[model samples]
Target: MANFHVYAAGTGSDVQHPTIRRIGVSDVLDALRLGFEDFWDKPSHYVFLGLIYPIVGVVLITWTSGGNALQLIYPLMTGFALLGPIAAIGLYEISRRRELNLDTSWWHALEVRNSPAMPAIVVVGIMLMALFVVWIVTAHTLYARVYDDAVPLSIGAFVSDVLTTQRGWTLIILGNLIGLLFALIALSTTVVAFPLLLDRDIGAYAAIETSARAIMANPVPMLFWGLIVAVALLIGSLPLLVGLAIVLPVLGHATWHLYRKVIEPAPAPVPVKAARSRKRSN
Candidate 1:
């Protein structure tokens, strides 16, 4: 375990963050397992995932409606993932509630509203949204450069073009490379920050620093963890995004557990003894 710093609430003092337990690959899996348990045990709390499905439904409708925007759909689909940390705030609260054996409610997922961390959380959300917007713009620019002004008329045409042409292949390859960079930046900054902010009464800077430190300290396992998240999200986005109803909640809950594994709470301050007075002889 390593010591880190966090602000002591009300006392206005900084203290060592205790419980910075060493994490490993097993911990990631264990967190996922626990997350699964949370979702499976109290499935109703995750219904918001279902509520989110309608948004995907609209995207699906748009896709099939025109079938011409295939080039843009990939970016849109993947970009949907960029906002996941903020979107899953409810699930984090749910897991927190379950951890304390409090009554977890679908409505209570919005407990984030009452939290002192709301401002910081809002800032994180804004940061993610900005990245998402940038990614969309960059992706469109790349696609435009590759295709010139011609747009695909259907899904079949887009796939055929993307698969058989040099421009298509290059765009796919380059687009993903750029997206990878964006994903890494997002992951390193946030993998633990969101949970940390929610779990503690600290500023966003400390939360972000803790998250980055965790990544730097455990690169290998963290890389694997990132891979797991990317793959899980990609798979979840399939099937009309309905799979997300299950995948998102599990990952959301798992993230809280992972944060617990990666970062420890600050140790309690040791009280100092007052010096003995010379009045003993008197």
Candidate 2:
């Protein structure tokens, strides 16, 4: 077996991005199918990782259940998707290893720490984290504006107000529009970035540029893919967020497959000659 630490380290040159391909709707569906297969084949391997989503969801919801912060619950749930690429890093690693017929043990996911692109990955992750934070703050501000700093005494009351009031409708419209912008930014930048990094040593800029290029090349398909993700996340969130344990793993695995479909194979490495030994001076 390949060393865990070296798994998913891209063999391509750090300066060059792999060629990008134009993928179609069929390709996206196939990627999801393959991703689901990966998840099904070794469901137990991902149980630990899958559970993290709902656990974090519950924690965030609980944390926001107090004070005026309760208004943040919806934003927090939606904002969770913004941080998904980072959260799914391990799933990417698992899928990569499975593609190579390597051991797909859950622990191997941690091997991402030793990847050649770890630094670049960290940079992108930090970018996503910043976006999430910005989204939370924006959502909170918007809620405060709609309600004039009034606190919802209970979840039921919040739901009723949001469903019945004009201000609530305004919040929904504006929030969805702003959230769409954020989602587009995340999708365009990260659709292939984390996977590309895991597969290659290319720097953050190149991986991100390649992802943007992929989006540009296949705008319709990319938009459809984004919609699919949004819908799946919404459904997964309905059951007290517990369904995310299954939904997230499937999406995470599929994202890796999507990257495979969008980016062409890395170019073959050029052979290098060994240096000649110098004879000792007489």
Candidate 3:
């Protein structure tokens, strides 16, 4: 069974906050470079996970197009940012293993299930999922308020309305402004939390606090990092979202490197008997 004790204080070890580092734009760039290297080293390892996004993208687009919920399609695509951290957990594991020179085969990505922090990871993932749901509901409400229960009849009509009308401009401006808030929240909280949890046994609370502290300590660099992520994802989303096949894994691996940059390495464990022997000799 997965260990749930990571959430309980002093369950196995004392819960202490990990040290947060103040990284700069250089560090962020280095992380991305290293991430790309990781992806290049074994592109085949990430193929399955990468293809999943395109498939899901196609399905969601079809669902919205068929159901006359065109307003929701954009929201759904943007909402992927909020859930991206959770989806990339497996990528983090693969990167972690490679960092240690361990086996990083495709199946090894699933090895995270045996991690001590799995339960904590699950909790944080659920939090992100809940946030996604809220964004969708809020988007729906925004559309309803502006359009008043009138669903766009077709893709061409929806595009024309969204592009040519005053209400369309209002929807565009307000939706983007609101979407920025949600994206910021996701970035602030999860920028390093998932990878940190996978790397160490820190509880979810400590992981989140440390991630927030990392951002607070280096807001400019972190914000720049967030911008890089948004732009990369946006580009990946073009061409039928197929580009994400390469973009997601690269970003995912890079995120692991980013966490390494932001968090200090865990301290080495002291030898218990050596302490007692030294005390007695003294």
Instruction: Give each model a TM-score.
Output: 0.85, 0.91, 0.95
lDDT, residue 157, model 2: 94
lDDT of 1 by residue, 128-160 (tens): 899999998999899888889577787787888
| Candidate topping TM-score | 3
Superposition error at 53 for model 3 (Å): 1.8
Model 2, span 1-282: residue lDDT tens: 222122233454345657878889999999999999999988987867988999999999989885457889999999999988898999999999999999999999999998877878888899999999999999888988888878889989998889898998999999999999999999999999999988987778888888899999999999999998999999999999988999899999999999999999987765443222222231
- Give the per-residue lDDT of model 3 (tens digit) for 77-166: 989768888878899999998999999898888888988888888888998999999999999999999999697888889889999999
In model 1, which runs have C-alpha deviations exceeding 4 angstroms?
Answer: 1-19, 53-57, 60-68, 268-282
Model 3 residue 72 distance off true place after TM-score fit, in angstroms: 0.2
As a TM-score, model 2 comes out at: 0.91
Candidate 2: lDDT over CA atoms? 0.88
- In candidate 2, position 178 carries an lDDT of 96
Clashing pairs in 1: 4-17, 17-266, 18-265, 18-266, 18-267, 19-264
